[model samples]
Every structure is written in C-alpha cells, then in structure tokens.
Target: MTRSPLVLLGKIWLALILVFLYAPILVMAAMSFNASPFYQLPFQFSTDWYAKMAGNQQIITAAIRSVLIACGTTVIATCLGTAASVALFRYEFRGKRILQVLLFPPIAIPWLITGTAMLVFFFAIGIGRGTPAVVIGHVALALPYVIVTVSARLSSFDVTLEEAARSMGANAWTVLSRVTLPWIAPGIVAGALFAFAVSFDQFVVSYFLSEPGDSTLPVLIYTAIRKGFTPEINAISTIIVTVSMAVMFLAARFSKFGGSR
Candidate 1:
C-alpha cells in the first residue's frame, strides 16, 4: 500500500533501537551458558559457570549485601518519596517549584560528579566510605525517581475525596491512610521497585563508597573485569540483568501503565 512505507520505516527504526538497547544483554546471556570460557563461538552449552558462581563465597556474600542495601533503599525512598509527592501535590506555596526543581539535579548530574561529591560530603560529615555512604548516595539517587513516579500517579487524584473525608470529621492521618494511600498503592509499589533497581544496579557511587573488602554486585563485577574476563563474569552479568528486568516487569505490572487502575 502507498501509506505503508512510513509505517515500515518506523518499524525498522524501532527494531534498530531495541537491538541497540538489548543486543549486549542478549550476547552476555548467551555467553553465560556457553561452554567456552573465552567467549568463543559455535556455542557449546554448559552450566559450569553458574555452578562455579554459586560456589564462590565472595560472590554470594556480595549478592546478599547488594540485596540488603537495595531493600533498605527501597523502603526509605518509597516512604519519603510518596509523602513528598503528596505534600507537593496537595499544597501550593512560594518556592515549591524551586523545591521540585532541586530534585532534578541529582538525576541529571553525571554519576561520576555526584559520586565524588558524595564522597567529599560524607567524608566531611565523618560517614566516610562504607555501606552507610552507599545507602545515602543510593537513596538520594533513587528519591527523585520515586517522587516522579508517585507524583505522576497522584496527578490523576481527585481533591474532593479528601475534602469529603475531612467534612465527615476524618482527621488528617485518617484521611491520608483511608483515602489517598489506597489510591496511590500501585504507584508506591512501582516506585519501590524503581528504588530497588537503582540501588541494585548502581556502580559508580558504590565503587567510590564501598570499602575494598565489601562491594555491591556491579562494583564487584567491574573489579573482576579489570583483573580479567571470565565466563563467571558472564554468569553473574546474566543474573543481574535477569533480576533487574524482572523487577522492572513487576513495576510495570503495578503501574498505571498496566491498566490495573
């Protein structure tokens, strides 16, 4: 058809973009199961790398620490972000726009600059480099994302519902707990997932903040690659990618994008 050319071109561009985004991940996943340690082709399949990964105590310890940090970041980020979103949405004040604008700098600034800045600030404050420092950086990085997600959800909320609850003699806490929170539950879930993903996948900040004996998965992976590339790297890379994708998928399921609400 005469009109089909533009549609075909759009489809081709989308396919190219997807390949650009996902090709490396696909290749890494493929290599994880390959028998060759050197990333050789003609693909003989094996599970030895994963078995080796499982047996590595250092990797297991790092993985647990990563999960714990991500969980902590998620909980703190979600609660604070959801509350901030509500306050921002429910009230109007001078410099409120300025406050909202401030959130963007953390997200927009280069991670290298942010990471170094965090190190300097934490050192000045005596926190220094460690799990606490990493959490502080991760929460700062993740807070904006959670605020944006929950704010987007809150944009569709009806103010009259809160007014009606207040008219019925419900207190501030009662109205928020019974009305606003129920409506924003999906957004909170999605925001929490985003927080978890951000912290779990973080590298630069964690690299600067984590002490030598302890590191998050991404930081650990970077150190391993610097030493040498191995199939075990591929195995862990595949797992990280898989787990991150799974978290985002669940986030999508809980978001308004999923058509649940």
Candidate 2:
C-alpha cells in the first residue's frame, strides 16, 4: 500500500505538536513519583509526596475550597447560561445580537485583565476579596463556555417539538421540562463539566478575587511555587491536571466536540 507524502507529513507534524504540548506535563507527572525532593537524576519512585500532600492542612483546605467554588460556579453558570442559550435559541428581540456578542469578552480577553477589572470593581462595590468574589468571577468566566456549548447543541433541536407539546396543553414549564430539556441534556452536562473545569483550573481570577488567608488550589500552588518547587507541588499539580483532563474528556464525549452532530 502507498500513502501520500502530505498525509505522512501532517501526521508527523501532529505528533510533534502533541509532544511539545504535553511533554512538560508528562515530565512533571513522572517527577511527582520521583523520590528526589529536588528532582535530581536517578528517579527513584516514591508515594511520600502524595502522602504529604494528603496531610498538609493548607493544601487540603485550598483543595476543598477550590472544589466547592468549582461546584458553585458550575451550578450558577450552567443555570444562567442554559437559560440564556434557550432564550437566544427560541426568541428574537432587539439587542439580542448585542447580548450574544457580549459573551465573547470573558473568553476573548485575557484572564489577567478580567481578573484585575473584577478586583477593582468588587473593591469599589465593597465585595472586596473573598470566596464570594471568586465564585462570582468564576461564574462570569464560565458562563460564556456554557452558553456556547448549550447553544451548539440547541442548534440541532427541532422547534416543532415545543409547538407540538404546547398544542397538547403543555404549559411553558411543562414543555421546557419534558420536551426541551431532554433534547439538550447532553449539552447541559457537557456545559456543566466545562464550567467545573474552568473554575477548578482558574488561577488568575481566583488569585485576584480571593483573600490572602483563604486561597483556591491554583492560587495556593502559585504561592508555593514562589517559595520553592517541591515534589508535593508536583503531586498536587498532577492531581489538578488529571482532574481537568477527565472533566474535559467527559465534556467532549457528551458534546461530540470533534464529531458530526
């Protein structure tokens, strides 16, 4: 059998790109298992770092905080974004396009800028910095992703289903719950997963919005790194990366991200 040169080149390029993107993460994950606290040569395996990470009160607290914030963000963002997506899908009105366009800034703009703006705005409004502020910022950041994901799934929805349900005396709520929601359930799940991942992995916004004494995992990791790099940091980072990857994998599976709808 013969293969085209271009196809081979493209495969080779993709391989290189994957290596470049994931090599550091793979190295870090491997190093987490290494016994060397300073990450020296021989690479003796040990689970001491994981055990230490489990015991560290600071890390445990930060991890719990991050999980709670992520869950809260997922719920809020998914609800709000799903409602917005349904409205955008079902109705037309003045400023609708403007509203849709507005979803981009949180996504298109860098988190650094968004985080700084949120910090300033919250301070002016007296919210200051805390878990509450971080949750708000995470929801805002996650909303666009949920909206976009749900809207994509909504694109394939049949409008007649709602009309048919309504003709059968189904109220708005009934139709929404019975007809519309089922069709878009996968999207909702995917969007929620995405929201969780966004909030869980979020650093810049959490860093800016969180209090010094109560920081999220990402912020805590940043603080730890400032002091020094240790196997404990690597272990925690590996856990974060693993969770993020799992979340994204579920999202993609539910959303059919790369496949035909």
Candidate 3:
C-alpha cells in the first residue's frame, strides 16, 4: 500500500529536525580529527589533538575532578532522591503537595540565576567556593532529575506487594529492601546516570562554585575557549559529547524512556 502524503511529510520533517540538531556536533567531531589547529578544511585526519589534550595536565586534572564530582553528585542525588520518591509514593501527609512542588525550582529556574543565588547563599553561610561548594550546587541541581525519574518508576509499582509483605510479617525495611527497591532498581540506575550527566555537563553552577585553578572539565573548556579556539579544545569537546551521549543512551535503555518495555 502506498503511504499517505502527510506521513511522508512527517518523516521528512523528522529527518530534517534530526539533521538540524546533530549536524553541528558532527562537524565539531569531524574537525577534532583534522590536523589543522585552525579548522582549515581539506579533511586531513590526525590524532595529534587528542594526544595533546591527554598531555595537558590542567585538562587532565579538570577532567578527573569533573568525574569525581559527578560521581559524588550521582551517589548523593540518587540516594536522597530515591528516598524522597519512595516517601512521596507511599505516604501522604500535610504539605506533601507543597514538598513535591518545591522540587521544580532547581530545574525550572535558569542556571545563571540559580548559580548566582547559590554563590551568595554559600558565601553568607561561610561555605565559600571550592570542591565542596561545587558538589553542593551540583547535588541540588541533580536532585530533581533523580526524583522525577525514580518517581516515574514508582508510579508503575504495585502497592499490593507491600501490603502482602506486611501481612506476611515482613517489616518495613524488609519490604522496602526486598520488594520496592527491586521493582524500582532500573529507575534508580537511570536516575544515577542522569545525575552523573547533569553534574558532568554543568558549567554555570560549576563556574560559580568552583575555585580558580580548580575547576570542572566544562569550566576548564570555557576558560580555554576564552583564550582561543584550538583543535585541542575540539578534541576535549568531542570527548564530552561522546560521554554524555553514551550516558543518556544507557539511561534510556535502562529506564525504557519514551518507549514501552
């Protein structure tokens, strides 16, 4: 059977949208392999830029710091967010709606505003700028993502399982550990991955919270770009995009996001 014109048009529109979104990233990744530091075209391929990026101690340090911070944010956000999600799912209390509503501002507000606010708050509280400050800001930003993801997973869970467990003399801890957690494990993993991505890719909050000479990879890249553009910067950027895409891909696979399981 022949397809409808509208269906054909929709496919074409989708293809165009995908191309529009990813074409620049493709070009940047391609340029990272080009030998010319200035991005002069002729498509000459070389790994020199990658090698140089590896050799740069500052970049290496920043990359390591970014990973460590992302890991820390993932752990804290996933644990706290998972607990909050469970609470929101299992119990109703006074101001529960208000608590749920409060989770949005960290996500809905612009990062520039949030970052400046955090900087002021931390200063006022005497926390100041550094890795600790960066971690705090990152966890705050990542919590909403984790909570939302885990809460979505919790939505599909069977409440009868908890009731049955309780009737069988299973304690709350036992039911939570053995039943509820097992059912939502995928969501927890996906949430952790999302937390990692948010913290890893975050620039504005990291910039405000991180101390000078000690910044995350995204912040370091911004500093480098300010000095000048180089193939080395392109190389590092390509790496970041690759890692972030890989993480989201895993998150989608685990969570079955936007698709039926």
Alpha-carbon lDDT, every model: 0.94, 0.96, 0.95
**lDDT digits (tens) for residues 104-163 of candidate 3:** 899999999999999999999999999999999999999999999999999999999999
lDDT of 2 by residue, 39-148 (tens): 89898999999999999999999999999999999999999999999999999899999999999999999999999999999999999999999999999999999999
Give the backbone clash total of model 2.
0
Q: What's the best-to-worst order under TM-score?
A: 3, 2, 1
User: Residue 8 of candidate 1: its Cα lDDT?
Assistant: 94
Clash-forming residue pairs, model 3: none
Highest lDDT against the true fold, candidate? 2
Best first by lDDT, ranked: 2, 3, 1
Give the CA lDDT, 0 to 100, for residue 75 in model 3.
95
Model 1 lDDT per residue over 48-124, tens place: 99999999998889999999999999999999999999999999999999999999999999999999999999999
lDDT for model 2:
0.96
